[model samples]
Target: MDVLVLIGRILFAALFLASAAGHLTRTKMMAGYAASKGVPAAVPATIGSGLLILVGGLSILLGIWADLGALLLVVFLVPTAVLMHGFWKESDPQTRQLEMVQFQKDLALAGAALVLLALIAHAGTDLGLTITGPVFDIN
Candidate 1:
């Protein structure tokens, strides 16, 4: 079971880790895309979002404050889905479909993040054989 949890954590954090790499590496390009999609303060937003996911990913991967990391992911996912992937605002059918998919994906990830948060809150993070035990003395 602990092994399963470790694997699941790695898999779940993979997407965010990859995304953070892209965000940090291609800041200007990503920021331009965000600006085109009408994001205010796109550059800083891109950097900040990258950092959020980075820290969030690291926190979860390291099993330190996984709850907080999950919350951070939720914060990033919800607004990003609403602000950047508002499919309803798209007119072109194909583009709308693409945006809708992205929107759905983001929401799905957010849902998963929320579930992780709930599970951690209820069960506590002291589950069996965690590679990295809970930190800061919180159970």
Candidate 2:
């Protein structure tokens, strides 16, 4: 069970880590997309979000401050979903459906992070690994 939990954390963290890398490495491309979605100061926002997810992913992957990591994920995920994946704004059915799926994905990820946040907050040292750390003993 513990190993499974670790694996889950690794998998979850991987998603953010990969995204962070993309956000950092492909700043211009990502920024252009973000600009298209109506995000102001898209370049900085892209970089900033990249940084946020990088740190958050590290925290989760390393089993340190997992609660904060989960919180950071929630912070990033929610607003991005609402602002960037605004399916309702799309005129074409296909585009709208795609955006809706993206929106739902973001929401689902956010919800999972929120659950981790709540669990970590209560579990403290115990959750330091999955919920917080079997590593640095930091939350």
lDDT of 1 by residue, 20-134 (tens): 9999999999999999999999999999999999988888787877777888999999999999999999999999999999999999999998877666655564565443444
Task: Return the lDDT, model 2, position 42.
Answer: 99
Model 1's TM-score against the true structure:
0.91
What residue pairs are clashing in model 2? 127-132, 128-132, 128-133, 129-133
Which candidate comes out best when scored by TM-score? Answer: 1
* CA lDDT of every candidate: 0.85, 0.85
Give the Cα RMSD of candidate 1: 2.5
Give me the displacement of residue 47 in model 1, in angstroms: 0.3
Give one digit per residue, the lDDT tens place, for model 2 in 8-110.
7799999999999999999999999999999999999999999999998888887777778888999999999999999999999999999999999999999
Estimated TM-score for each candidate: 0.91, 0.90
